[model samples]
Each structure stands twice: as structure tokens, then as C-alpha cells.
Target: MDLNLRKAILSNISENDHKQLEATIVDAIQDGEEKMLPGLGVLFELIWEQSDDQDKQEMIKSLEQGVQQANTGS
Candidate 1:
């Protein structure tokens, strides 16, 4: 079978409103199953693609800080 995971994931929630999207994200995150990662990645990819340079930089900085905090058990 030919399967495009990203395509499937995007299509699944393409019509979501902002609150629906937020609920999806929060639910997936709270569930914390490995399978949810790819869906989150796809959503993040959409965000990154739409973001400007400054926004991208801010995301990178936040991610960096998050990683550092995780590593330190903070």
C-alpha cells in the first residue's frame, strides 16, 4: 500500500477551526504517544513554512531553550 503520512494527517484536520486545532494539539500532546509526533511535526512544518524570519528565529530560540531545560530536568 502506498501511504503518504503527512498527506493523510493534513487532510484529516485541514478544516479545523482555531479552537479545534488547539484541542487537537493539546489532546495529542497530553496523550504523549509516539504516533502523535509525526502529526505534531506536520503541524509544526506548516507553522514554520508560514512564519517570517523573525518568527522563525523566535521559534528556534524557544526550542533551544526548551531543549536546554529538558536536558537539565527543569
Candidate 2:
């Protein structure tokens, strides 16, 4: 995940939950090294479940903008 996505997620979650989620994500990332696609799917599901609709939309928009910037830069 990009910094923007991580920032958005952290912004929305409570401090306590954020720490727990961070640990969970770190563990998942380590596990994901052996199974990348599945690990990514799990990460997405975890983020999506914790996020509200507005945050989801914001993340999508941020990603879209990033793609556009990259395309234009190229």
C-alpha cells in the first residue's frame, strides 16, 4: 500500500485499534511474502472492513489521482 492509503487508514482508526491493526498488518505482510496475491487480498479485505464508505471513496480517489499523475509524468 501507498503512504496515502496508510495515512488515510490511520486517520480513521482509533489510536488503540491503530496499534493492533498495525501489528496485524505487519504480521500479514511478513506472511504475504510467501503468497503475495492472497496476502494482498487479505490486506484489502481487512482495510475495507475497517473503513467506512467515505474513507473508501477517499482512498479510491487518492489512488486515481496518483495513477493520473504517474501517467502524466510519463
Candidate 3:
């Protein structure tokens, strides 16, 4: 069976309110389970698609900073 993971993930969370969506992300990150990564990636994909260029640039900057911080443990 072929699984459309992005569609499946979006379908599951489509009804979530803003707070619920935030909680879902927080909980998933806190849980730190490998299974949650795909859902997060799908969510980020949705955000990236919806973001304007400025928003995307800001997100990229934030992510770059975060990755650097994580790598340097600072």
C-alpha cells in the first residue's frame, strides 16, 4: 500500500485550533520520538508553502542560528 504521508499528517491535524496545534508541536518536540519528526516536517512544509518571502527568510535565519547553536552547544 502506498502511503501519502504528508496528506495523512495534514488530515489528522486539519481540525486543530491554534492552541491545540501549538500544544501538539510542543508535546511532539518534548517527546523527542523519531516518529514525530515526519509530522513536524509535514507541518514545516505547510508553513513554508504559506509563508511570504520575508517570513521564509526569517525562518531560515532562525533555523540557521538554532542549528549553529546546537552544534556548538552554546
Candidate 4:
């Protein structure tokens, strides 16, 4: 949440991309209870849309590990 990190994330984005991201984020935040869920939805959609087979495999593996950790009370 640092300013530097925010700037870094925006560094490669176009103006249009920035506008879209800002709108989506603001909408998500205004929803409050489910705030941020939409942003995560967008991220997951992008990952699945753009990732190669190996990338998806790694993502699945990581998620499985996370599930295991959560189930084990970590």
C-alpha cells in the first residue's frame, strides 16, 4: 500500500488502463462488504486469459498449497 508500490503498478499502464482500473477499484471500494472482490475477480480473469499452461499449472499448485495451509489452521 506504499505510494512507491502504487506508482510502480501504474508505471506501465496507459491512461485508458489507469482510468478503467480506477473506476473498477472505486466501485469495489464503495460496495464495502464485498470490496476488493471485484478487483481480485479481474485479476483472476486476466491471469487465466493471458497465462500459458505452465503458468496456470504453477498458479494451481500455489492455490492448492494455500488451501492446505488454511485447512491446517495456519
Each prediction's whole-model lDDT (CA): 0.97, 0.69, 0.97, 0.67
What is the C-alpha lDDT profile of model 1 across 1-74, one tens digit per residue?
Answer: 99999999999998999999999899999999999999999999999999999999999999999999999999
Model 2, residue 35: displacement in angstroms? 5.8
19: Cα error in model 1, Å: 0.5
- Best-fitting candidate, scored by TM-score: 1
Each candidate's clash count: 0, 0, 0, 0
Local accuracy of candidate 2 as per-residue lDDT tens digits, 2-64: 456545544544464667767756876677675445545555777789999999999899989
Which ranges of candidate 1 are over 4 A from the true structure? Answer: none
Q: Per-residue CA lDDT of candidate 3, range 21-51, in tens?
A: 9999999999999999999999899899999
Q: Lowest summed lDDT over 10 consecutive residues: which window, candidate 1?
A: 27-36
How many pairs of residues in model 4 come into backbone collision? 0
Residue pairs of candidate 4 with colliding backbone atoms:
none
Candidate number with the higher lDDT (1 or 2): 1
Where does candidate 4 have its weakest 10-residue lDDT segment? 5-14
Better of 2 and 3 by TM-score: 3
In angstroms, give how far residue 44 of model 3 lies from its true place.
Answer: 0.4
* Candidate 3 or 1, higher TM-score: 1
Q: Deviation in angstroms for 53 in model 3?
A: 0.6
Candidate 2 regions exceeding 4 Å error are 1-37
Query: Which candidate order results from sorting by TM-score in descending order?
Result: 1, 3, 4, 2
